[model samples]
Target: MSIGNTFYQHKDIHKKTWRHPDGRVSNEIDYVCIAKRWRSSLLDVKVHRGADVGSDHHLLIAKFRLRLKRLPPTPQRARPFDVMKLKQPTVATQFQLELRNRFQAPADCEEAEDQWTQFRTTLTKSAEAVVGR
Candidate 1:
């Protein structure tokens, strides 16, 4: 553990977190402590005099910045379609006819990803209908 008071520089009034009842004496009695390993994450520590806590000690504020770890993405598994059905003459002819009737070129210029997605959808639907999945 480490004391956060010494980590930051501030005015005397801001540093004084506590005061004596006589009003003639004051001191930094309050403290903000943190782990030594995360010392660099502690941005600033100071006293907030504006807070009306109704106590001899003032409010101590500590600022910190933390970065969360990112998770690794899981790989997606692709399902295999029944391509063996295409060996039959009737299935092959029906698959070819379905592709010819459903396939259409884009009306305007489009992104490569969009075109690939459209083509993949058409092929998958046609294969499921004419062949099997």
Candidate 2:
């Protein structure tokens, strides 16, 4: 643990945490301690004398900033097909024939999303068979 006030600069009045009963002397006795690893997150530390808790010691305050990390997005599909194989005449013809045969089936899906999903699956399967991933 480490003291937070030592890291920041403040005036004498803002740094003092306690006052003598005679009302003529004050001292910095209270402290805001935190873990050494999280010291960078500690922004500032100060004394709040306005808070009336009926105690000789003033209220101590410590400010901090914490940052959370975001997670990476998940992949939606498998590996992609190597379309470069289609550059050859024989591979392009084979891929075209496969796609034609697969698409020949009637898509009786009522929703547009189902129709698109079926078309995408058929195209991907055909490409996988004709090309290399």
- Scored by lDDT, the top model is 2
The RMSD (Cα, Å) of candidate 1 is: 10.8
Candidate 2: 10-residue stretch with minimal lDDT? 101-110
Q: Please estimate how well model 1 matches the true structure, expressed as its whole-model Cα lDDT.
A: 0.87
lDDT of each: 0.87, 0.88
Candidate 2 residue-wise lDDT, 56-102, digit = tens: 99999998997667989987787778878889999999999999988
Q: What are the runs in model 2 whose C-alpha is more than 4 Å off?
A: 73-133
Clashing pairs in 1: none
Error of 2 at 83 (Å): 36
Candidate 1, residues 1-133, lDDT tens digits: the string is 9988976779999899888889989999888888898888899998998999899989999999986679898897766888998999998999999998888895563888888888889898898888876
Candidate 2, 96: how far from true, in Å? 27
In model 1, how large is the Cα lDDT of residue 24?
89
How many clashes (backbone atoms < 3 Å, residues ≥3 apart in a chain or on different chains) does model 1 have? Answer: 0
TM-score (C-alpha, index-matched) for candidate 1: 0.55
Candidate of highest TM-score: 1
